[model samples]
Target: MSAAIWLGRFLFALVWGALLANLVWPFPGKGFALFLILLFVLLAIHLLQLLMFASAYRHFVQWRRGDYWQIVVFGIVGWFAILNAQPQREQELKR
Candidate 1:
C-alpha cells in the first residue's frame, strides 16, 4: 500500500474510534451534536458510494462481505485499493 492510502486509512480509523468513544462516553455541548450530524452525513455518503461501486462492478467482480465493510469504512480509499488490486485483464475490461 502507498503512504497516501495508509494515511487515509489511519485518519479514517481515528474518526471511527472517536465516534465509538463518543457512543460509550457521550461528549457534552452542541459541538458534539454537530459532530454526530456530520458523522451521519459521512455514513450516508459512504453508503451511496458502496452502492455505486457494487452496481458498477457486480458483473465483473466477485463481491464479498469484507469488501462491502471496507468500502463502507474507508470510502474512496477502499475503492482505490480494490481497483488497483484487480488483475490487468480485469482492469482493462473495466475501461
Candidate 2:
C-alpha cells in the first residue's frame, strides 16, 4: 500500500466524518433550507474537484505511473502523489 492510498483513505474518512458530524449536530438557528443550500454548494464543489483531477490526469499522464483507478478512488491524495513523483528539471545555463 502506497502512502498515496493511505492519505486518500484518511482524507475520505475525514470528509465523511465531518459530514456525519454536521448531520448529528445541527447548526444553531439554521433551518432546513440552509442545509439544502449547503448540500448543493458541497456537491458543486465536489464536481469541481473531480474536473480538476481529470484535467491533471490528462496533463500529467507522461510522468504518472501506477493504477489510474487509484486516482479515481483516492481523489486528491492520489493526484498529489503523482504530481509529487515528477522529477524537477534543471534549468540550462544561457551562454
Clashing pairs in 2: none
Encode model 2's per-residue lDDT on 1-95: one tens digit a residue: 36656767687667555655667886557654576565566556656666677676665544334535445445566566555544431112222
Compared with the true structure, model 2 gives a TM-score of: 0.39
lDDT of each: 0.82, 0.57
Instruction: Mark the 10 consecutive residues where model 1 has the least summed lDDT.
Output: 83-92
lDDT for residue 89 in candidate 1, whole number 0-100: 45
What TM-score quantifies how close candidate 1 is to the native fold? 0.80
For candidate 1, the per-residue lDDT at 55 reads: 97
lDDT of 1 by residue, 1-95 (tens): 66778888899999888876776777898767867887898799999999999999888776657888889999999877776666754656679
